[model samples]
Every structure is written in structure tokens, then in C-alpha cells.
Target chain A: MTHHTASAEELEALARHARWLVLSTVADAGAGHIGGPLSQMDLLLALYFNHLRIDPSDPHRDDRDRFVLSKGHTAIGLYTVLALRGYFDPAELATFDHGDSRLQGHPDMRMLPGIDASTGSLGQGLSVAVGMALGARLQQRDFHTWVLLGDGEIEEGMVWEAAYAASRYGLDNVTAIVDRNGLQQYGWPAGASDRFDRRDPWAGKDVGAIFRGFGWDVIDIDGHDHAEIDRALETACGARGSAGRPTVILAETVKGKGVSFTEGTYRWHNGIATADQLAAARAELGQPETVGVAR
Target chain B: MIAQRQVWGETLVELGASDDRIVVVDGDLANSTKADLFAAAHPERFVEVGIAEQNMVGIAFGLSTLGYRPWLSTFGVFLTHRALDPIRMLVSQTGAAVRIAGAYSGLLNGRSGKTHQDVADLAIMRTMPGMTVLAPADEHEMRAAVRWAADHDGPLYLRIARDAVAPVFDIDTTWEDWAPRMLRDGGDITVVSTGVQTSRCVDAVRLLADRGIDARHIHVPMLKPLDEDRLAGLLGERVVTVEEHTMIGGLGGLVAEIVAARRSTQTVTRLGLADGWSESGPDAFLLDKYGLSASRIADRIVGVHSRPVGTPGV
Candidate 1:
């Protein structure tokens, strides 16, 4: 249950490896989300590798810290992190999104270990984390609950409802991490005459202020920075930022980070990467190329 | 006569005394849903989640994963309509052991009108995978159903009527098994009902006997995972279903599905809120207007009984 603190440099290396795994997994599956996973990879790597108090061998231990991916569409990122964390063999990830595979299109807690809750529908996992925090209080357990949400997914009213509950209950044991990637799949499409009309409607909203209004302690950090992610997570878990109030870390990030072509664009939000594109992405990440292997 | 919500609140308090793992989550209607009694008895275990039913359900799902038995109390309409997505994704899909106490079910919410009245909760809950749907006939059955729900370790939905209903079962009667209770025995035709309507059906069967109809009455407390074999065995050639819900998909739909799948020669006459919404009124007035009162139900059964085979009856 002790934190295996990794240096920022080691965490950055881990994030790069996880990003490669995420993109390769999605491209091999021929269908999966790319942008959100790439954007959220650093946050997941920082939490799973350095922060979360979980044992991969005993994933279902009662006192283990729980993590829920509220914006579950980017499950490939979480799956890659779990694989690298030794919860399962990294080789098993090849079956992701395949029929009868434990790695589903969305995270299925019942089907896979280390997955705390089954979540695909957005905006519900934070409430589940709040309940887990409450349960820990009622049971007198010290385990913490961490939930990752998407900036666009916050459009759901249920997310705010959970935000209010987490604050009203004084759930200091739970922390919410928002991937402020500044893009979504669909938005105001550009008309023929106006190319500037196309943009993410959820981008530029004051998400941290809204969470603060909900009585949460807001921490703004660069999501792709491992040191900032680690620091914010530590402050939140220590209940040092604002005692008796849940903390929400609005991690500013770019959609499709770490890839030159996909970064900051919504086109790669969810699509298959062609063979050449996958090779280019691997080459960019400094990974050796393999011939005739989709994965 | 006692309201089912009252029994639910009292039973929750009783359960909380023995099991500390029991928690109650309410959506700001604690007093109306009678969850206030449990909150008073066990303040720490009671979670007041404001007017957010969907969040209440999600919280209960999370608690269920942590080995806590959390019961969410709210109006049936909100639980089944507004919070159905969470109930489906978090509770039903994962088979979480979260109990949903859907109060103000049916057409009797103290004149709260159609918005508060829940006439289709049974149909919605019954169709959810791994969901145990129950509608007690009266206070006695409500007490038993609450206890059963606590002991059960899966997703469950308890439909509770807002108004006081006539008792159909004895005080000592318990839901020891999932079988439809036969309240009356006769030979001519079978009358099956669920929830509060079962009590009215009991009275209607008595009135039918007075008219020489010889009706048999059956009360099904458990709607989902229904005791189909037992119910199918007890059904006669002519079966009439009565409920406070819509005729399309409640008890009537269940009976029709069972009979048709059995391929038996039985004819099902479904009597309910005839394909429309009901206006807000007193429970008795609404029942009478919707052809669900004891006398009206008896009259409808008579029409069905006297009609010749292969012809539609009123």
C-alpha cells in the first residue's frame, strides 16, 4: 500500500511507452479512440505507476485504492497502463475490442481485473467514486478513490450532481481528475463559407471555477507534466489543499498529444490509424518498427 | 389501512438496527418516501443526496461494490425515468446489489398528477437484466418484501404505492418462496393481479362470486423472475389480469407472454389504465374512473366471462 515514487523522468518515459501502446492497440484493433487516450496517457501513467496504492497481483483486495475511468471511451489508455503495471500480461492487450476478449471497447470491471468499476456511459463514474469514498468512511477504511473525467463529458448534468455530493459529504478521500484536452468528437461543423465555425463547444469553459463553485478544491496543472500531476495528486490525496473538501485537478492537455499529425486536432478523436501512420507514430516515439505485425 | 411507504421506512429502520452495513440514500423526499424514519434511527447511515436520483443510484452502485447494502428511495417515476440510464449501466449491467425503493408508484401520489404517478415502473424494472422486481399487495407483504430485498445480493426494485391500500395477506404471511399467492379459489375463471391492485382484485372476485361468476384470485408479488411454472399451473382456461399500470406491459403483459409461450388454450383479458394517462385525483376516484375499482373490475370480468369464445370482450 506504499507509493512507489518514480522520478519525473522515469514517469515521462513510462508515459511515452504507454502512449505507444495505446496508439498501437487502437491501430491494431482497426477501430478505437486515439486523441483522448493520447491526451490522458500521462495522467494515467502518473497515477498507476507512482500514486495509486494497488497491487496488481491482488487487484481485488478490499483496501486497495479504487480508480474509475468516468470518461471510459479512452479505455485503451487505462488498459495499457494496467498492462504495464503488471495487472495482466501486456500481450493479452492484443485481444482488446475483439469478440470474447476481456478487454472490451469500454472498461468492464466484471471482465477484467484492476478495473474498479464498469464504465462506458459518461458522467456516472464520479458518483460511483463518491459512493466508494463514503463507503470507506462508513467502514472506517483509509483507501482512497480517484476518478478520471473528460472535459467534454462534463456536459452531463449528472457529473455536477456527483460533484455537489462529493463536496456536501466532505469526501476528502476521493479526487477527481479532468482531462482538459480542449476537443470532442463532434461540434459546430464548419459551413462551406465559414471554416472558423468548426470548434469544440466544450473548449474554453471555466471547468475549474465550476468545480470550485461546487465546493471542491481546484488544482490547475499541465496534465502531460508528470511532476505537476504527481504534485497535485499528492496534495489532493493528503487532503492538504482544502481539508474536508474533495479536490478536482483540471489537467490542461492537448487532444492527441505526442503525435505531430494528431496533436491538438479533433480528427483523430476516434479513428483507425493506417499502417503508414502507425509506423510514423512509432518512429516519432523512438520505437523500433516491426514488419507484417498489426500490433 | 397502512401506506406501503410507511411499512418500507419502518422495515428499513428495523433492518438497520441489526445490520450496520445497511445504508439508505434518499433524493430529498425523505419525509414523503418515509425514509425519514430510517434517517432518524440511523443518521450516519442515511445519505441525503438532494433531488438527484441518478446520482443517488450511482452512489448506491458504488456502495454496493464495497459490501454495503444501500437502498435508494425516491419516486418511482424519477427512479425509472430520470435515473434509468445509471440504473441500467451501473446497477443492472454490473449486477450490483443495490435496492431501489420506488415510492409513489401507480396512480396514487396524493394528487401529484401524471408527472409523479408511475404506472409503468413494473414494466421498466422487469425488463432490466438481473433485476428482481417486486410489488407488494399491502403493508404485510411490503414488510416481507423489504426483508427479502435486504437478504438478496443482487439488483432489486421494490414498487411502493403512495396511498394506504386494503390488506390482502395476513400479518404473518411471508415471502418464503417466489410463488403467486392464491387469495381465493373458484372454478369458472382466474383473476390475477399485482401490487395494490391485488387487494382490489380480491374484493372484485368476491363481487364476481355474488354475481355467480366463480372467479379465482391470484396475487403475484414478484413480477420479474416470476414463478411461471407455478402460475401457469394455477391458471384456468380463462384468465383476466388487473393492475394499476398500463395494460401493455405490466402484469397483463407478463401473463400474456407466459400464456402465449406455454401455448395453452387460455384466454387473457387484460384490464388496466386503458392505453392513456390518468388525471390527478384521490386513489379511490382514480381507480373507479380507470375501471380498476372492485366493482368496476368485477363488472369487466363479468363482461369477459359472458362473452363467447374467440370474440373480444370489454
Candidate 2:
């Protein structure tokens, strides 16, 4: 729960900072998918601050790792990470979705820095990441690619398509993390369909087995737990193409993790942050004590 | 009528031969999609993502970002509808300079029914910011469009009609610019045409000339980023827009907006599909039924010429 290693402390601070960034940016506008962003903050924080070898100042630097937020509707999470990591001045976060602001509802790679690909439509980001991984191998660039997917987005057939190809090519340099929040927009993922009686379809279907069939090393872990995410990423770092497998990190997380009203509820997938709601969210996230806001 | 898909495939092969970075990615329907030519010529650069249009588009975006000129081919219906998420996200969002070739465009796929016919592809694609749409009039124009797309920056969606259409222009004529080309010029009236209907417009021009009427023909290859300034300067006011697409949000609508904005003394007439589901028939039969063929367009020109000079309808 507490940080000891400098790298660990630095990463934890970045994750905490990303949390504050999302809270303040979206809160200022009085709207945003505060829940989804809050849920994925820790994962993005860990990737940018610890796992990925990227320079914020040199975002387009050749040989740098690529990260794509395929769940683009939750761009607040990515904006938070980008701003906190200094990809752009934190002041730019104030202009999120405003007229003339490059910070759109989804990732717009052309208009902003530190964006590998523009992704707002769900279930496409991972496939693009696969190509990035393939291109890296062809060019002999040794960089890894990471894709963040939403639990609801998994329902899209394209996710499986990319998964199959990634395994087919033995793309060990590529890693996919599912923000398994259990709830999508309409209802609980399990209740969305009458086909299954289980609470979690991901488990019964053997997600690992499916990936293994396509020759992928699948690992499931707690998304909020930094130590586990770090270890899994480290293991992926050692994989070789000859090994005939890619890597998947199935991260289990609450839909609105850290917030009381929105947590575990589908209604908050895209809930707005009102003035009172922002205060309540800040108190729950321990925002002020962790990272100071400029205002 | 030659299928534009053939031209797209052939031009891609030519691009592949000279440019190593020219790559083709197709959905599972490679044979029907007509990307097999590029596959056979450059096996290393061609990829087939089995039945996954979303993944196909996404991979193309990845390839484009890595300095490769990727040509993604798929059925128009699936490419525009099923892959909308990727098309909007990966292509529009990232601003990837990828070229997307959609075969079986419009109702060219006769027997496939509603699900397969992409009646609204142009309308949908044009709505996306920074997307360049090209519906080449015939094989000659199709080849030129593909060649231009390879060198052009930003995302491009190419709608290739399936029906076999006659070549409207000779390849040796040398059309180099990305802007709309003036096939035949006259001050009396400017007939704006796009895609499959350009061939009809050519025929209409000849018919009007026979009737002692001078009708100008302007063939637009690129739909988005409309060349309004040039169009307004040349057209002045007299314009009739024609297309084998819906009158709503198609070529007709685009030209009408420009002509209206400029308010040049010439009256505007539109000939396109009516606001409803199109009746099933052979491609030519459908064009004829919708008054999109040469005879139908010529009739529209005559009707416009008959109108009083002082009367310009809003």
C-alpha cells in the first residue's frame, strides 16, 4: 500500500497525479466520464511512469513505446496521464472539449502530443497497436506497444480479431490490458445477456485458454494493484518471438473504483462531475493530500 | 461499365512495384474485394485479416503511422458500417494517411439486398472531419484517383462502383490535379457530376449539343473539401448537379449549397436518387429508373433551359 523503491514511489505519485488531473479537468467543465477515467487512472499512471520507456518531451521519438487508449470515450483518463507526465502543459487540461481545444471527447492524435493513435470508437485501438508492434519488429525497433480496452468494448468482434492476429504473429512485444469494470453502459455485463448465468463471463469462457489457443501468454491481475501490474509487464518484457506467444494482462477493476455512488453501477459509466459531485469524488480519491491543483 | 474495383486493384499493383512502402490490407473477401492482384504481386506487403473489417482498418492505420502507404480494401457496406468505429477512430481520430477502397459501392451489388448496398456511404464518410472521399466516374478516373491517394496526405475513402462501366475519359489525356476536372465547358449551364453518373453526364452533354444547347460538364472526383472557389468562379450561377446517389447529402446537395451561397444568376437543377429505398434491378436499369442516365439528365437540362431567365427558385 505504501511505496519504498524510488521507481515505485515515482510511479505511485504519477498515478495519484493522474487521478487529480482527471478530477480537476473534467470537474472544471462540469461534465465528463468521471467514473471510467477514475477506474483506469492507476493503470495508465503505472504504464507511463514505470513500464513504458517514453520521454514526455519527445513523444514522437523513434523507438519509444506506444500506448493507445482504445476505450476512447474515457479520454479524460488519457488526458490526465498526458498532462501529469508533462506531454503538454497541465494548463492545457483546462481546455478539454472546449471550442478550439485539441482535447476532444476521444483521442485526436493529430491535434495533441503523446497520442500514438486517435481512438474514440471502441474495439479498434488494439488492432492498431498490433500493427505498431508488427512495424516495430519489421524496422528492428525493439519497442513495446500497450493497448487499454474497456470491459464493454470486449463484446465487439474486432477485439477477438486483433487478439487472434497478435497471437498468430507471436507479438510478444505487444500487451493488452482490459479494464474489467464488470459494468458497461446499459447494465451489468453478465445481465446484458441471458446466454450465461455466471456473474463473470470472462472467467467461465476461459479468456486465457482462448488466447492460449492463438498462442498468447495470458495473465490476469488486479488493475489497481501496482505490484502485480509491474511484475506482469516485467514478465512480458522477457518474451521472445520464437516463443510463439503474445501477452495479455486481464486487469480486474471496479467500474467506478474509488467513488461511492458510482462504484459497481452501470449508470456512472459516463456520469458527469457536478460541483458537489466533484467535491465528493475529491474527498473519496484523497486528491488534495496526494496532488495539489493549480487553482 | 468497368468496375472501379478493378482499376483500384491494378493501380495498387503499379504503386507496389515502384514503392516498397505501398501495402494492401483486405478483409476476408479478398477475391470479391479485388485486392488479390496486389496480394499476388507483393506477397510481403499484402495482408488478409480474415472477415474482420474493424481489424483490417485498424491495421492499415498502424501501417500508415509507421511510414507505409496502406490501401485497405473491403465491401462498401461492411467497410463503412461495420468498421465505422475504426474508420472514425483510427482513420479520422489519428489522422492516419491510409487509403480505404470500398468495392460493391451503392446498389452495384444487385442481388445482395439492403444490408450489402451502401446507399449512404458518401454521406456518412463526408461527415467525418479530414476524410477525403473519391467516387471515380469510370476506370480511367479510378486509376488516377488511386495514384493521387497514394501521394496525398490524410485519410481517403474510395467508393468503387461494382457495375461494368465504359471509360469516360482516355488515360492518355493526362489529368494530374486532385480538383474536379472540366470535361466540357459552356457558359449556358454547368452540369456538375460525380462517380458513376459522370459517364451519363458525358452522354447528356452530347445529346444537349445535338439539340443546339451548350451544356458545360464538370466531373468531380473528390467529394470532400469541395473546390467551391474555383467552381463559383467558373460556374457563375448556372449549375445542374447529377449523381447515382441520394439527392439528400450527395453531389446534388453539395453543388446546390455552393450555387446558392454564390447566388450567380443561373438556376440550379438536381438529378439523383429520391428519398427512399431504391428498387432492385441491374445497375443501368436502376440508373435509368432514377433518371440518372444520360437521357434523364438531358431531360432535366431541357426543363431548366425552358425556365424563365429572371426566375431563380430558392
Candidate 3:
């Protein structure tokens, strides 16, 4: 009930702040999954800052929409968004991944509020969300289950397994948004180089069609475009009540978005920024030059 | 006694009838895993998660968070290995209330070849942090353990056997006691065994009685959350541990650790399959080859009873 609707301009600002915070926290902690989180920040902002029906005052309400960061290595970004959303003090983002910090490399539901399921290992988060959506059906609750997964994680067979089960159950209440930057832990997978001259690295294949084949309501859109992201969110939320098919928002994102050197690259996916790299990223995000150096 | 898997399926149906939160998930092995009994009773609550064990575990973990007690069943081999990480993270790490009935475990899947046989399940389940591992001796204990598991506060793995077993204890036996149940009392040697091996030890007692030697047979139900005092009490002059598992981290390894730490003077002899795969055959032949038959167990206990005190046998 206390949600503030973010306009396109405000949503862009939120995305900027999220990207700045993600780079800052990873830079401070000396390590994190920077590329994927940067890729998914705008998608997260559209949901958390505007669309997601959650209560910061009462985080565990049964009827609230559930958001699971299945691409859980992106805790730096989600932790920042959660803090900005008032789940906790914003300053705690500095202590992420440090010794004795509640913000571990992966998200742990037991360690923090506003977290529905703890995840880090790829491919299982969607299944958790499927279970939640099915639970909402069985328990007669009117809440939504939104999961954010990574593109590389789709390689895991378990993701397809979850895809089949979600489709079988007709989980209209579940919406899975994939941060499809197209590169995994290592760079583009081996066969991609020979496939399409390495251009449109999903090998010129469509991720939306993949989900469509699995019987999901597919929405292919630019993840960084606030308007497209909002439209997909509205379309997904409109099918909320029951008997609706599950939706997969194929958000075409750039890995390491917002920072010039790291954008669309794999080098900064799992690492700490160097002094120069950190300064470059800050300047790109137009963040103030502060003394929070990478330790 | 009935088959542990049968008892598991029946108890699931009975539990599902009474508890609205009880939901059963099967991994395309409903007939083998015996979750079909629950399906018949409460089809709405029974979910066939196809052949995907990994997704089945994740789905169960999801349901547990929503105030529902999710019961999962699949072959021990696939459930423990195929979805091990998901079970560890979704269920074990968070201590979720996901009661997993690991069916067709141990060398009991004699005709199904090496792939179906899972002697390492006890070790794998035991190694997980905060996972409650239970391998009951008989159907009575299996039913008791299943009932206890339905209400057990956290993640639990109940190992079920493929074959039937004779009743080792009363119907009202307390499966959650975490202590070994003493079957026969004797002072010469303490023979601790679990799962179907416990019954073979009972058969071994008759052979020992004929040789003027006495044997104390103890049937342990809960492999993890072991009762330290009961284990210490059962560790007599000579200790013999037998299990339908490998000597790695099953009953034998667990008992040996306790004996070594608490009673250093006690000699511990372990009887189980050697570090190798079991070939396809009748369960009896495999048991005999592995030195788990009644005669082998009888001879083992006699050897331990006659050996000098604190003299360990390989």
C-alpha cells in the first residue's frame, strides 16, 4: 500500500544508483559477481522500486509478491536495492562479503529480511519460485513469485526441468526474468565463435522462442529500457490470479552494463575492480569520487 | 514385517489423510518408490515430478516454506547424487522441513545391478550439515520413523529398503529416540548393526548360541543424531558393527569413531561391503560374499569374543 510509483526518469535514476552501488560495494569488498548484477539492475529496479507488491515494514506478509534472485551471485546488486528499498540501512552495503557480514557472497534468507529464498548456485532459483507459486495456489494466497536468473545458468539441465514443471502446473503467478547477457563464467561458449561469426551471440537464436517452446508466455525486450521493462512487468502482473500460464521475460541485457570497460565483457563478472577501473566505472556512472577504495 | 518402502508409502497415505500439510512428490518411480499409495489416497496432494530428481527436491523445498510438509521419494542413488547440491542448499543449509524417503537403498537392489545399488547413501546423507539421517531396522521402525519424519522440524532422510523384513521391534517403538535398541543382552561381545543387517544379526545369534558363545545384538535405527550414551553403553569388551552399507561412514564407521573417542580400550570390528561395487545377483549371495550373512556374522562375533582384550581385527 505504501509503494511509490517510479516514472521513467526516476526509474533511470534508480538504475543508475543501483549500478553505482553494485560497483562500489564490489570494489569495497574486493570481490563479487559484478557483470551479471549490473546486467539485471534495471529489471530489478522496475520490480522492486515500482511493480513488486511488498511491505518493508512487514516483510514476511503472506499476500506480498515474492522476488527470488536466482542468479544469486548478484547479491551485491540485490543487497543494494533491498537497502535502498529500506529493508535495512543503506550503509551496510559497504560491509558486503566481508568477514562476519550478513551479506555473504550469495544471498541467505536466514541472514536477512526481504529475502524469500537463499540462492547462489545457478538453475535452482526458478524451481524455488515455481514451488512458491504452486504453494500460493495450494495455500490459497494471492501473491506473485518473480525469479531473476542468469543467461549462462540456462545451460544447466535443471533449469529446463523447472521450465517443464512450471509449464505443466500452469503457474500464471510465476514470472521468471533472465539477465541474458549471453556470456557465462568464461566468455561466450565454445561453439558460438563458429556459429554466427560471434555476432548476436545467442548464436542468432532467440531466447524468447526457447521459452515459448516450453509453453511459457514469452516477452522479449531490452532489459535496460525502462519502458519495455515496465510493459513486460505489467503484462506479467496482469495474469496474476490463477490458471494463468507462467511467463518468462527474456530481458536482453549487456553483461557488466553501465561501466564502459566492463560492459558487454566477461572480465569483471567475478572480481574486484582495480583503482583505475573503479575510478573509470564511477565516472561512467557519474558517481562522486569518494574515498571508498577497493581494499 | 513388510518392506520398508511399502510401509513408507502406506504411512504417507495415512499421514496425508490426517495432515492437510502433508504432500508427496515422486520422481517417476511412484511404483518403485511406492509413493503411489499416497497418490491413490490424495491425488491432489501427490505430485509426479517426472524423472527429474533435482527439480523434485527444489519443488519440495519451495513447498516447505509455505507451511506445507513436503515428502519426497526417489531411488537413493539418484536422489542423493543427481540432486545432492540442491538438497544441501535448499533443504539442509536452511533446515527446511523436507522429509525425503530415500527408497531402494543399499545392496538390497540385488537384481538391479550396480547402478541401482547405493551403499554410500548413509555416508552421503550423514555428511550433510543439519540433515537427520534415519535407517530403520524393520517395517515397524520404518513406519515409526516415517510418522516422526512427518513432524520432524527440519530436513530428514529416511532410507527405505527394497525387500521385506521381519519385525525387530514393537509397533509402538520410538523411532526418534536416537538410541540403539538392544535386542539381546550378553556380556561377551556387543554386535551393533542397522537397516536390514540388524535382522541378520538376530539370525547370527542362533549360530553363536550353539558354539557356547554369547552375543549381544543391538539394532540402531537413527544413524545420525546418534545417542552417545547408548553407543558408549553398547560398546562392550569387544565391539562388532554391521550394516547394509559400506564401511566408510555408515554404522560401522560411526560406531568406531565413538568407541575410539570414548572407550579407547574397546576393539571395534566392522562388517560391510568392501570398497567396491556390488554385482547383480540375489540379495543373499551378495550378503554372503560381503561377509554379512548369519554364519559370517556369527564367526566374526566368535572371533572377537575369543581375541585378547583391545586387540583390533581388520
Which residue pairs come into collision in candidate 3?
A172-A244
Q: True contacts preserved, each candidate? A: 0.84, 0.84, 0.70
Question: What are the per-residue Cα lDDT tens digits for candidate 1 across B127-182?
Answer: 89999999899999999999888789889999898888789878876766867888
Q: Please write out the lDDT profile of model 3 over residues A1-295, one tens digit for every residue.
A: 4554789998777777778888778878777888888888898888988899998888888788888899888888888888888888888887888889888889999888888998988899988998888888888788888999887788788999999999999889999998877677764444634321123345657778889898999888999999999999988988876446899999888888888877866666777777788778777777776533334
TM-score of 3: 0.95
lDDT string for model 3 (B5-104, tens) is 9888998888888899999888998888889988989998888889899999889988888888898878888988888999988998888999877888
Considering only chain A, what is the TM-score of each predicted structure?
0.93, 0.88, 0.92
Best candidate (score: TM-score): 1
Q: Which ten residues in a row have the lowest lDDT in candidate 1 chain A?
A: A190-199
TM-score of chain B of 3: 0.96
- What docking grade applies to model 2? medium
Candidate 3 lDDT (Cα, 0 to 1)? 0.83
Write down the lDDT that model 1 would get: 0.88
Q: Just chain B of model 1: what TM-score?
A: 0.98
Candidates sorted by DockQ, best first: 1, 3, 2
Give the lowest summed-lDDT range of ten residues in model 2 chain B: B169-178
Considering only N, C-alpha and C atoms within 3 Å, which residue pairs clash in candidate 1?
none
